[model samples]
Target: MALSTNCWKYLVLTFNALFAMSAVVMFGVSGFLLYRLFVYRHFIGVNVEYPAILLLMMAIITCSVAWIGWRTAKSMHHFHIVLTGVLIFLVVAVQFSCFVWAMVVWDSVDIDIKNSMTSFFDVANEVNNPNSPESIRWDRLHVQKGSVPFSCCGQGPLDAKFKPYTADCSTLYQRGCAKPLHQYTRQQLLMVAMAALISSVLQK
Candidate 1:
């Protein structure tokens, strides 16, 4: 079926509106992630941050693209239309790149988190100076972050003790946080994947 000029214009406007909304959504999500990492950057490495920053940039570009799309819909100017098309392509490209980058970071960070947690536990156990740089950070992670109540001292019940530094000492949890944290990371990756699919398919 052939569409009239009015139908095409309406379609473009509708898509532009949706695109703008997606930009806002991406901005919120990426901004939140960036804020979280900024707070706990000491605990988690900055590797995952690259994708998040890229997503933030993508959101900004997407907003520009959507604005251009909206104006192009009204004026139907050749140059504006061409610019909007190019910007749309750029948005999708950046989104897909970020998705791949996120997955790669996820794979590496999961393992690194466990080892890092173990080291933090070790640090908390060995280091007597509570005010030391490492101790301060781990203390916040342990007691403040509820790391102790959340899980056991080590990987297992008989593994070792994570005491002295921590205030809690009555009982310990046998389950380590690695599996649970891994699941959470998987969930985040799933969200990224879904967003990438929506952005690529619908936007394209």
Candidate 2:
């Protein structure tokens, strides 16, 4: 029975180490995405990067909590084991709450993107060249390796060429950047939540 318990403890530790590493990786990814969004924030309009920031914060918190879990998992001290369980429980609760909240607000994410894109299109139409910052940013997103804009069929019947500041709804990709970005963020949060759940189970 003692040997079996030791084996189970080590198994949990292995899982904890994996979770800790994943949290670290998530932290880096969220930070990078936040940076990218910040760079193009002027054209994207208000509150565009807020979700990314939230994710980054979550990642940071997970990393810290995961580290504690890992350390406790490796330690045989009775107090450490009890403390680890409590900490894992708290983290799991907090993470789940945040995840659900984020999902609830996620429905409006597309609307915000639409609003931002509308503003972007209005400004882009007014400019003839990529001379303006907003226009340049708009062009930058669609710019390919050969400096050509990749045209996509939008809602309009006619497809518009994505060139400099001339890209309108017709010229932009049917799947807007915002949709994919928001989806990816949502998925990331889900992944984090799953990881947290697994960690909680392992703690038990």
Q: Which candidate number has the best lDDT? A: 1
- RMSD in Å for all candidates: 6.9, 7.8
lDDT of 2 by residue, 107-201 (tens): 45566656777788787878755577666666665452123343332343334565434337553445445555455444544454444344335
Q: What lDDT tens digits, residue by residue, belong to model 1 across residues 21-117?
A: 9899888887876665555555555565667777788888899889889999998788888889988997898798877877787778776666666
**TM-score list, all predictions:** 0.69, 0.53
lDDT of each: 0.71, 0.59
